[model samples]
Target: MKKNLVRIALGLALVLLTLGHSIRLYQHPLLSHLDAITYDARLRLTQPGGQDSRVVVVDIDEKSLAEVGRWPWSRDKVSRLVRQLTDHYGVQLVGFDVVFAEPDESSGLRVLERMGATSLKGDAAFLASLASLRGSLDYDGQFAATLKGRPVVLGFYMSNGIPQGALPPAVLPAGTFKGRNILFTSWRGYGGNLPAFQAAAPAGGHFNPLVDFDGISRRVPMLVEHGGQYYESLSLAMVRLLLGNVPVRPGYAEGGSGSGYAGLEWLDLPTPRGALRIPVDENVATLVPYRGGQGSFVYLSAADVLQGRVAPASLQGKVVLVGTTAPGLMDLRATPVGEAYPGVEIHANLIAGMLDGSLKHKPPYALGFDVVQVLLVGLLLSLLLPSLSPSRATLLTGAVLAGVVGLNLALWQSGLALPVAGVLLLILALYAMNMSWGYFVESHSKRQLTQLFGQYVPPELVDEMARDPERYSMEGRNAELTVLFSDIRGFTSISEGLDPKDLAHLINEYLGAMTTVIRHHRGTLDKYIGDAIMAFWGAPVADPDHARHALLAALEMQVELRRLDAPFAARGWPALQIGIGINTGLMTVGDMGSPLRQAYTVMGDAVNLGSRLEGLTKQYGVGIIVGEATRAAVRDGVFRELDRVRVKGKDEPVAIYEPLGLAGSVPQAVLDELKLWQQALRCYRAQEWDQAELQLMNLVRLNGDCRLYQLYGERVAHLRQQAPGDGWDGVTTFETK
Candidate 1:
C-alpha cells in the first residue's frame, strides 16, 4: 500500500507539471512547436480539395508583364483593365491585392505642364493642345473615375512605419469597442490608396496577413485596430460587399464581457441569405481555409483581359481579385499548402470559407478545453498505470493514446482546433517513468538474491530462487538432503614431491574439475577443506531426487578425475584419483560459523558419516561408497553391497554399497561375478571354509586384482584356523575413522 501511494504521488506530480504548460502558466517551446506541427498536418489532411468557382484571380503574370511594361504601370492602363472587367466581362466585384500608395507619373503630364508653364508660355497653339489633353493625361483622375459608383474594393496595407496616403473610413469607429478587452492585432500606421482613389472607391480593406513565428501565413486578422479604430481585412470587406454591403457586428461569448474578457469570437454580418457567422480566434483572426495548393482559383491574365482575349462568360458574375503572380513582384508568401504561395489567394480562400461557413476555429475557450483534456488524460493514466502489470500497462497506454488521437481528430472534423501534443507527451512520459521504476525495483531484488546465494549454488539455481526470494533464506533449518564428500587419494605424499606453487596450481585444477561435475548435477558446494570438497542438494533450492542426483555426481566425479590424468602426466606430475562418499538423511543446512568468518554448510550425524565413508574408500578399493539410506533412495541405481560396518563413532552397523551405473547399464560379466561373490560371502559368514575357499579362488582367478574378494579370503582362512563357534553374523567393525 505504501509503495503504491508513492508511485501515485509521482504520477500526479507529472500531471501537474504538464498541466502548467497546457494552461499557459509556463511555456515549453518544444511542446508549442509540436502543437503547431500537428495543427498543420490536420489542416493538410482535411482540406477541401476542389476549386472555389465564385472567386477568380486576375493575375498580372509574366505574360501580362511581357506584353505590358514593368510595375507602377500608368493608372490609365489599370483603369482600362478595371473597365474591361466590369463593363466588358460583367465581373460582380473587384478587389485589388495591390496598393496605389503613390500617384502614377508615367503619363509625362508633368513634363508637358512644365513646358506649358516655362518653355511654351506664350505659344497659343501648344496651350490649346495641352488644355485639350489635360483630362486624358490625368491618369489618377481617370482611375478614380473608373471606380466611381462601382463595387470595387481597393486593397491597402497596414504597417508600423510612417503613415502614407489616405485610409478609408473605419469599419468600427473609435470608442465603439471601449471597455472591451479584445486583443485585435494593432498597427501604428498604414500605406493606403491616394485620396482621390480612396474617395472614389466604395470601400477598401487592409491586405495584411498574420504571419506566425515560423514565418508561415496561416491566418488573417478580420479586424485590425489602428489609432483606436478597427478596419476590416480585404477578405472580410469583399465578403461584405458580395452580400449587398452588410454591416459587421462583434459576436462575443456568454459572460465574456462581464469577466473582463470580451473575446471577439465571431464576425456577425447579416445578409439577405442569412446571418453570416465567421468564427475568429483570440486575436480576432480566422484560420485560412486552404482549398488546395495553387490553381485553386481560375487565373486570367490582365493583358488577356485588356486585349479581349478572355471570354466574357468565364468572368461573368465572378468576384475578381486583381493581383500579381509574377516572380519579380515579390508578392509570394509561405503558407501551409505551399512554400511559394501567391499572397492574393489567401484572401480568396478566406472569402470562400466565410461564405460557405466552413472555417475551422480556435476560440479563446479552447485554452480551457486543452487544460481539461490534458488533466483528464494525464491524471487517469498516471494513477492507473502504476498498479497494472507491465503488459497490462503497455496495453492501457496504447488504448489511451489511440483514444486521445481519435478524440482529437473527431474534434478537428467538428471545426474545433484543440492541441494534442501536450497530452500525448504526458502519456508517454508517465508510462516511461512507471515502467522504468518497476524495472529498477525488480532488478534490485534480483541483485540482493544473487549477492546472498551466488557462491553457494550454480547461476541457474540462483535465478530460480530469485523468482520466489521469500521462500529461501540463510537461517538454519532441518531438511532431508543428500551430502557428498570427495578427497584426493595420497594428497599429503603428492604435495611433498612438488613445490608450493605447483602444489597450489595442481590443487586448484583438480578442485575446479570436481566442482564443475558437482554443479553440473545441481549440487550446492558447501566448502573445500584442503584437498577435499563438500557439497549438498535439496536446500536453498529443493530437488526431490537429491539422493539420485548426489550419486550421479559422485560417479561423474571419478570420470572427471580420470580425464585429468593426461594433463597431469604432461605437467610431469603424478596421476590423481579421488574417493567420493554420499549419504542421505535429515541434516541442518544454512549459514553457520563464528563472527569473524561464516560459511553456508551442513552439520549433523549424517554429514559426519558421509565424511567418514570417504575415508574408508581406499580400504575397500573402490572409487565411491554410499550409506544405506542413499542407496535405498535411488531405486534405479545398480549397486554391489560392500559390507555391513560399524565406523569409529557409531555403535549400530550400517550397510554400505558401491554404485555401478544404472540398472540396464551393468555388463553381464560383472553381474556374474557379483552372483558368485554373494555366494562366497554367504559361505564364509556361515563357517563353511572349504566352500568359501573354492568360490573365493574362482573369483580371484576371474579377476586377480579384486580387493574385496582377497580381503574376505584372508578373513575366512583366519576364522578356519581359530575355529570359532557358529554365532557369527556377516558384519565388519572399524575402530578408526
Candidate 2:
C-alpha cells in the first residue's frame, strides 16, 4: 500500500511541477512563439483556399513598372489611375498600401516655380503661364483631390523609432477607454501620407502588422493607443467605411481581474445596420485569417487598371487595395502561409473577414478553457497510470492524446483558437513520469527474479519468467511435478582408491556432463550430493510435460556417461556407472531450508519414493528406474515392470519399472528380451518355479550375464522349496533403501 501511494504521489508531483512551470512561463517568448507556430499550422490546415470576391488586389508588379513609366510616376498619371478605378471599374472602396510621404518631383513643378520666382524674373509672359498652370503643376494636390471623399483609405506606418511625414488625428480620442489598466500597442512615431492627402481622404489608418518575435506576420492590431487616443488599422478603417462609417469603441469582457481591467480583448463597432463585435487577442490584436498563400483575391496590375484593360465584372463592387508586389518596392512580408506575401493582401483578408464575420476568435476566457483542459487530462492520466499494466496504460494514454487533438481540431474548425502546446506538454510529462516509475520500481524486482531463475533454471525458462516475474516465484507451494534422483554405483570404493585431488576433478567433470544432459531436456537442477544428483521438472517455470521431460533427461544422462568413459579410461580412472530414478507426483518445491543453510529443492513422499527407486536400480541391474506413476505419465516410453515392493516408510506397495527408450527407437531384440523376462516374472509370481526357471534359462540364453533374470531364477527356486501354504502373494518388500 505504501509503495502504491508513493507511485501516485510521484505522478501528482510531476503533474503539479509541469503545470506550474507551464503557467509561470506561459508568456515566455519561446513558448509563445511555438504556440503561434501551431496556430499558424492550424490556420493553414483548415483555411479555405479560393478567390475572395469581395476584396481584390491592385498589384503594382513588374508588369506594371514595365508598362508604366516606373515608380514615383507623375502624380497626374496616378490621379488618372484612381479615376479609372472609381469610374470605369465601379469599385466600392480604394485603399492605398503605399504612402505619399513626399511630394512628386517628376512633375517639374518646383523647377518651373523657381524659374518664375528668381531665374525668370521680370518675365511677365512666363509668370502668367505659370500662375495660370499652377493647379495643373501641383501633382501632390492632384493625388489628394482624387482621394477626396470617395471612400479612399490611405495606409500609414506606426513605428517605435523617429516619427516622419505628416500625421492624422486619432479615430478615438485618448482616455476614451474605461475600466482597469488597459494595455495596447503604443507608438511614439509614425510615417504617414502628406498633409494634403490626409486632409483630402475621408478615412485613413496605420497598416503596421504585429510581426511576432520570429518576424512572421501572424496578427495585426485593430487599434493602437498613442498618447491618449486610439488609431485604427487600415483593415479596420476599410471595414468601417464598408459598414457605413460605424464608430469603433473599446470593448470589454464581462468578468475580469475585478480591477475590471484584464485589458482590451476586442473592438465594438456601432453601425446603423447593426453593432458588430471584432474579436482580438490580449494585445487588442486579431489573428490574420489568411485565405491561402498568395492570390487568394483577384489580382490585376496597376498598369492594367490605368490602361482600362480589366473587365468591369472583375472589379465592380469589389474593394481594392493598391500595393506593390515588386521586389524593388520591398512591400512584401513574411506571413504564416508564404515567405514573400504582399503586405497589401493581409489587409484584404482582414477586411473580407470582418465583412463576413469569419475572423477567428481568441478571447480572454480561452485561457481558462486551456487551463481546464490541461488539468482534466493531466490529473486523469496521473491517477490512472499507477494502477494499470504497462500495455493498458499506454493504450489509455494514446486514447487521451487522440481525444485532445480531436477536440482541438474541432474548436479550430469552429473558428475558435485555443492553445494546444500546453495540453500536449502536460500529457507527455504525465506519461513520462508514469513510465519512469514502472521502469525504476517494477523492473528492479523483475531483474532480481530473473537473476534467481538463472541460478537454478534454464535460460529459456528464465526468459519466460522475466516477462512476468509475478507468475513464477520462490515462495513454497504444492504442485504436481516430476522429481529425479541419480547416484553413482560404488562411488565410495572408487573415490577411496583415487587421490583426493583426482577424485575432486573427476567428480566435477562427471557432474558437469550430467548437468548438461539435464539442462538439454529443460529440467531444473535441484542440488548435488557427494556422488548423487537431485533434479525436478515443472517449476520455477511450468511445463505440462514434466514427466516426459524427466524421463528423457534420465535416458540422456546415460548416453552422456557413455561419451565420458573414454576420457575416464585415459585418466586411469574406472568408467563411471550411474542409476537414475524418476517419479511424477504432487511435491512441495521452493527455496526451502533454514536461514543459514538454504537451498532450492523439493520435498514430500514423492521425493522419497524417487530416492528409493534409484537404490533399487542396482537390485534390478538397470540404468534407469521409474515409479508406476511416472511410467503412467510417459505414454510413448518403453518400460518393463520390475516388481511391486512395499519400500520403507510407505504402506502401499508401489510398482516400479525400467525405461529403455522410446518405443519407435528401441530395438526388436530388446523388446523380445523384455517379453521373455516379463513371462518369467509372471510365472514366478504364480509359484510356477519350473516354468519360471525354464523361461529364465531361455532369457539367459538370449542375453548373457543378465543379473535381473538370474536373480529372479534364484528367487523362484528358493520359493519353490520354502513354500508351505497358499498365502504367498509373490510381492517383494524392501525394508531398506
Clashes of each: 0, 2
Model 2 TM-score is 0.58
Candidate 1 worst ten-residue window by lDDT: 254-263
Over 4 Å off in model 2, which ranges? Answer: 4-10, 21-30, 255-262, 436-737
Per-candidate Cα lDDT values, in order, are 0.90, 0.86
Model 1 Cα lDDT, one tens digit per residue, 1-737? 46688778888898898889988899888787788788889999989788888999999999999899888788999999999999999999999999998887788888999999998989999999999999999999999999999889999999999999989889999987678788889999899999999999999999999998778998999999999999999999999888888998887777233545567788889976678999999888999999999889999998999999998888999999999889899999989899899999999999889988999989787888889988898888878898899999999999999999999999999999888988888899999998888545577768888888989899899989988888888999999999999898998999999999999999999999989988899999999999999999998898999999999889888888889998899898889878889999999998999999998889999998999899889888889999999999999998988888899899888999999898898899998998998888778778889999999999999999978888888888898888777666667889998
Q: What TM-score would every model get versus the actual structure?
A: 0.59, 0.58
Ten-residue stretch with the least lDDT total in model 2: 254-263
Error of 2 at 312 (Å): 1.0
